[model samples]
Target chain A: MDMYTCDSMPSSRSEGSARSKLLSLAGMSKSYSPTVCALNGLDLSIEPGEFITVVGPSGCGKSTLFNIVAGLEEPDAGSEIRFLNKPVNKASELLGQVSFMPQRDLLLPWRTVIDNAILAIELEGKRRADARRIALDMLPEFGLAGFENQYPNQLSGGMRQRVALMRTFLFGRDLMLLDEPFGALDALTRTMMQRWLLDVWQKHRRTIMFITHDVEEALFLGDRVLVMTARPGRIKLELPVTLDRPREPDIVTSPEFIRLKRELLIAIEEESRKSFAPTPSAGH
Target chain B: MNVARDLLKHLCEALLRGALTVLTMAVVWELVVRVGGVPSYYLPSLVDVLAAVTVAPGAYVDSALRTIAETVLGFAGGAVFGVLIGVAFFQWKALRDYLFPMFVISQTIPVIAFGAVVVLWFGNTLWAKAVIAFYMTFFPVTVNTLQGLNAVDPRQVALLRSFGANAWQLLTRLRLPAALPQIFVALKLGATLSLLGAIAGEWFGDSVGVGVLLLHAMYNEQIPALWAAIFLAGAIGTLLYAVMSYIETRFVFWRDEL
Candidate 1:
């Protein structure tokens, strides 16, 4: 983990030691009630602009982790989080600092394309006219220029997701947490979205933590992939991609890509068994 | 230009349909009384009813306007109060748990039973009738508003919360807007209810409104006059309901409903 950080961070800020990254969390734990422990002792860190992928089994608390980071869910005490080198005591302190896209598009049905694109900025109490101007400038890149007047229902699933992405992007370009962004898309659309996402990510070099169930997607997109444990979720493995950036589509068939995919699949399969097995585990 | 043209076209179509409906009703009513040899005392002919209205057109018009004004006043007050209460209920679970059941209990005590008491308290004033309408109009709006607010997608709320939206912001921007289709549904129902309330209140001794006219016709054994009062009352309720539906259509244009 120590070596992985140095290797990926080419633009590492050297204001001396302590390795001040974009975000870092240690000893994170969350439990809904006395019986339901969702996450336990999860430690993770993100570099300035590295795209990281997270994969886990069905009940493994990926969403919980994202919620904690997004400031929607407060983790149990004993967790420590630091963002932009400042210690965040409350989960809400991280809000507006990290951009998040949930499993669904969640576009407001009533809002037009341009209006939807600026939802986050509007929420932040910015002047709507200025947000509109900013969103208009960025609309074409998201392939939503002509659909400015159109509502969310009028757009295709892919376009709606892009619009949501634009909303997230327009809010802040520092850190983005995407949970299965293309999970609902068909195979072809998902593949297309991945490529499009890569193109957009390149254009705007924002650090992203993308969660996906697809091993291939995790391999195709990440600078590193983190496989989480089942139930009381924690980082089980963090494998660096070691693949070249601006990666070609044909590289999925490459030996290196296949090798990485196998490694991630093995880690995920082990955890999936524990969650699915009809047996009494130590914790209920 | 196109939107206005479309609105005009919609209005003309609606009017045509309404006219066709009234014509069919009138024809059926006239045929039943005349062709079936129904006595005039039992069921007045449509022509007799129309002639009754023509004879005291000024009185009927004045009475109808008074009832409508009362209904409108009550409806607006009830709708506004209902929404505010709904929001309050949503904000505080404890308050909702305590007061909501009382509201439900209050509803069970028939509005008509205590309607006389309302008249006793406020006495024969428009305010009394409007208060009754307000009572009738509020409960459904409150229930529907609370339901609508609760029905907002939790994920959407989470998304907004992630954007640093405070509770008030969440209510105003996400919950309220998302709850609108449901709220409008209640408003349409409330429109009819308020009218019913206004008329019912007038029954507890008032001399100006259609309710007073209805009582007069019933006692005098003037069957045509009674039919005329019924038609005017029906017209008032239909007018109020039409206004609500129009506002709902214009505002909640995105909702996929007829």
Candidate 2:
């Protein structure tokens, strides 16, 4: 772990910035109602090519953060957002700037595998045939070569997620926000997908900020893990993982990995207990 | 080879079942009249109705064709216009708010009441009858089109929007296709209303259509002739409904999942 504080992370505004930051957020807050605040005073910075994982209790505004970044919803007026070192004024300005994947794969039921992958490209007014050609070349690497003509229902759970991932990757954005992309998979499939995702990430080298409830997943996949507090969420801990790349499945059993997992679990459990503290929020 | 044989078997079974159902209905109709000893003035025999149609087959055929033509013209016009208006309503809330109550009021005014005005406007041509049919058909289509468009999953809309889809792109690629099943529901109802509208429109001084023949039979107490016209009209309606259903199944292949 670097000796850097996540609060005033001297990465984005540093004078000796050898390389520029990919994304930075300060005072990022969202409130659905006057009484209900979802996110409060979020500050973070992401460097290019970093795989950042976030863990928080349920209703911790993880998805709200993602929506703001994906340009689906606006943050409060005073919040600061900078992408590629340029200040982002409104969420609309960030539209189509980041590739976003929600919890579900959300493949169009009507579109075929190939058509679904090229949807973003086709939406940009590119010819369907040309967009199709681009998707065809990248199919094999995503392990979906023979399944071009097949529909979403024809594919298995893992295959469906791959198709969604393929769609996100093909959008050609510098940053990707993945909200529990593999949360629906079975355990064995989830393990296989996590490793395959790292392989894909390494090859593409795009900045990724992923959200998950699983502490092990956070430790195994993320370069740095951000643990968040309960309702009215704010970062409680930012634990940097020093694990080397090309990490095998066996590395998950290493002592260092276990130590990091224990620390994260403690931080997350504390917040989880606070949320369960006897209050009207629980029954609702 | 096995798949082809299975398909053949399924088609044969469907045909056999449909034939059995018709046979049962025919038997019940014939028995109800003969055993109950109903007067010919009240209920004509099944064979009498068929024989009546066969007796003046040429006239019956011409009337049937004319009525069908009017219905088709009206149905086509109503279908195209309803969807266009439905899309307009969906895209512009202000237009929907302004004109939707007018549409409801228009629907409330009975088509039979509208038929007289339609005849006055268009004269005794097929255009008069078709106008009534168009009137009867468009409201349901408009209501349903708006409903179907609104029923689109917002998540799916969001997914497309995040991909940089503009409004037109959203409608054509995602909204329209997704709303097809609901739109087809409106279309099926419109088919029936158009046929009803056509027959009703024929009541206003048309001398050569099925509605005119029915009026002639009723006034002159030609019970078999009335029954014959009624049966022919029923057959036409059934045929149109089946066509609509077949088209719906063909287009809405993903409806099962939705």
Candidate 3:
């Protein structure tokens, strides 16, 4: 465990310590009633501006981990989490600091693209005009510049997700927690979205905790990939990717990329096989 | 669907419906008066009713306006109160647990059975009619609004939580907006019941409004007048329903695609 003075931490993170001590989960466990243990004693940390992807088999508490960090679920036992150096006692305290993009793009069906983008800022008490201006500036980056007047249903799945991402980005938060954001996209669209996301992330440079089951996705986008075991999830391993930035989609065929993908596949396959075993372990 | 074609087809169908309904009602009235051998004093021809409506237009119109005023007031007040109650229940589980069943039980008592009680408590004024209408309209609004609030997506809640939205923000931004469709359902139901409530109150006690006029006409065996009053009541109800539908379309238009 590392403890740094709040003043020494990056000032960009308004919570406690800066220096990318960004988000850490230590000895954290969550149980939904008695029968289900969603996460068990999971320990992990993300640095500032780091793109960390959590890859796990389905039902491995990847989304659960996001929920715990977002304050949607209370952990059964753990040391309190600090954003900067300040204790994160409740879900609301982390609101403006982290923008969460859910698996399903939950754009308000009634609101236009621009309005949906402005929602978080409006919730934060920014003037409608200002929030809208900020949201407008984000449209071209997401390739949704002309669709401002359009409704969510009018957009394709990939476009909708881009709008969703734009909404999160326009909220102007430093940390973004994405829960299988591109999981619903088709393969080609998913690739396009991954490229777009990397471009957006490069420019915004906010710390991100992305949850996905795709090992390749984790390797492609994350600075470090955290592989979680099946149910009663725990951080099985964290592999750092020293791959250079501005990488193209074709980089997935690179030697280093192939090696990392095979390693992630083996680790995930081991977990998948364990998930089906007769007496899988409950707590790590 | 082609937008203009759909609209034109819908309008033509509606007009056809109007003609068919008028023809059916005329046949039923004529049959009751002729075949059932009911005297002209009790049940008159549709023509007679139209004549009565034309002769005493001011009287019927005045009563209708009064009844409509009561219905509108009651619906608005009930909707406001119901929304507040829904929001309160959404926030406090303990309160919801204790109050929700009570609210349900209140609905179980037929409004007619409570009519006299309402008059006794509130007296025979327009305020009393409005109170009765409000009671009739409020429960649907509360129940539907609560369901709307409860139906908020867990993921959306989580997303807002990540943004560090406070309880108020979560409720206003996520829960309330999610509740709009449900709230609209309640509003539509409330609009219909508001008319019932106003008339029910007047039936128990009150010398003004359509309900009272209907009673007087029934007493004098003025069948045409009675039928005219009935027509006005139906028209008013339809008008209120149409207005509600328009408002619903205006606000929750997103649901039209679904």
Candidate 4:
């Protein structure tokens, strides 16, 4: 965890640096019906051009944390959420600057692949011709050049997700909130997608907050991996990965990679056991 | 067989099957009429019916036009009104809750029941038939369009929100296209109902149109003319349905999956 933070945190910085701090959430908590506390006093910050992966056990409020940040849900008693230092109330305030991709690909099946990619731009006031041009340009860049005119149903699950990612990027958001974008892919496909995503992210470095349950994926993709505890999830630890530039799958086999992965697993397991353990001194 | 031959064989088989089925139906009808031994004054033969169609074709054509006009006018009115209502309801949740029950309740009031009241109000004009046709057609259009608007994927809505798309943008790009399939469904239902509305209006009040001609034939015991009028009405209805289906195929090619 100490090594993780040091790699991501800049050494010396004056006020007004080129790297803009995009979002900050402090003391954020949320709860709902049937008495479940989803998030508990979560504090986090996203720096521009930084990739942050959040990993935790199931029901750790990872999704809840994302919803609050994306303005999909209200934090119970939290302070204002700052997007570029301005308080966000609804989706409209953060429009055009942050594009969100949910667990599902969410591509409209009736439309062709090209149309699906161009959907975001078309909604942003570009005419059909310009939108198509922009969509076509994103295809080859994302390794989907020839499949532009195909329908979503015609493509495999992985290809459909690629189309979805292209659509999200075409929207031109400075920030992207991706919730398990590759969670639905098969093992072989997921690894391939991770590598492909890394290549894409390098060319166009947008600040990203990816939600996942996989520890290796977190270490592989994110500049910093944030581990959250079980129910009423709070930040348990933060790990910054300083492996190397342009990450490869072979990095997972290294001693440092294994050590970091083991540490994250231990942290998550401890949180899970603590939540499940029967209350002490209950015998009366 | 190769692909082309297979397709050709399927087409020939379908055509042959359809013709055979229609021939059987006609033969069964003729046999039933003969066995019943009803007088010619009450039920005419197929030959008598064919002769009636050719004897006074002008009057039959005029009545056909009037009925067709009523169906077209009512269908257009219902479609326009249904879409407007659908858009308004989708845009405002509060309005949707308030107006949805009212729209459902409107369908419960039968067309025949409404026709009597409409005639009392419009006094046997073309408007009376149009009102009946509109009543029959409007509900399907409204209900189906509402369903379509609601059917847009929630994930897509979230994606739009993230992209900074405003309310208008969501409606035009997502909701409108989603609602199109439902609109076509409404059109199919409305087309058939519109014909019924026109005929019902003529039954209750109109001095012209196919319904009026059928009434004259029935009163005079001219069984051949009555059958001829019925045939023409069926032909007109089939034409209306065909035209609407063709339009649906052309515009909503994407709906082939659904």
lDDT of 1 by residue, B1-258 (tens): 976776667667777899998899889988998899999999988888889989989999899999999999999999999999999999999999999999999999988998989988999899999999999999999999999999999999999988988899899888998889999989989999998999899999988899989999999989899988988998888777777777777778777621
Off by over 4 Å in 4: A1-20, A85-92, A274-284, B1-20, B31-44, B93-106, B116-125, B250-252, B255-258
When 1 and 4 are scored with DockQ, the better candidate is 1
Query: What overall lDDT goes with each candidate model?
Result: 0.88, 0.87, 0.81, 0.80
Put down candidate 3 lDDT per residue, A6-113, tens digits, no spaces.
Answer: 111111223454455777666666777566777766777777898999998888888877776766667764435767646677644554677778888888887899
Query: Candidate 4, residues B1-258: lDDT per residue as tens digits?
Result: 574565456556655876798689778767767888877776677778989879988889899999999889999999899888888887788998998898788788777777788899988888889888988888888878888988887767877776767888888877887778789878988998999999989989777899998999989878999999988888788677766766675567676554
Across all candidates, the chain A TM-score values are 0.92, 0.92, 0.89, 0.87
TM-score of each: 0.92, 0.92, 0.86, 0.85
Which tens-of-lDDT digit does each residue in A176-247 have in candidate 1? 999999998899989988998999899889999999999999999999999998877888899999889889
Q: Distance (Å) between predicted and true CA of B96, model 1?
A: 2.9
- Docking quality band of candidate 4, CAPRI definitions: medium
Q: What TM-score does structure 2 among the candidates reach?
A: 0.92
Query: How much is A6 displaced in model 4, in angstroms?
Result: 30
Predictions' DockQ, in order: 0.65, 0.67, 0.54, 0.50
Per-residue lDDT tens digits for candidate 2, residues B38-97, read 898899898998888888899998999999999999999999899999999999999999
Error of 4 at B235 (Å): 3.0
Computed on C-alpha atoms, the DockQ of candidate 1 is 0.65
lDDT of 4 by residue, A111-197 (tens): 889999988788778899989987887788777889888877788999989888988888777788889999999999999999988
Ranked candidates (DockQ, high to low)? 2, 1, 3, 4
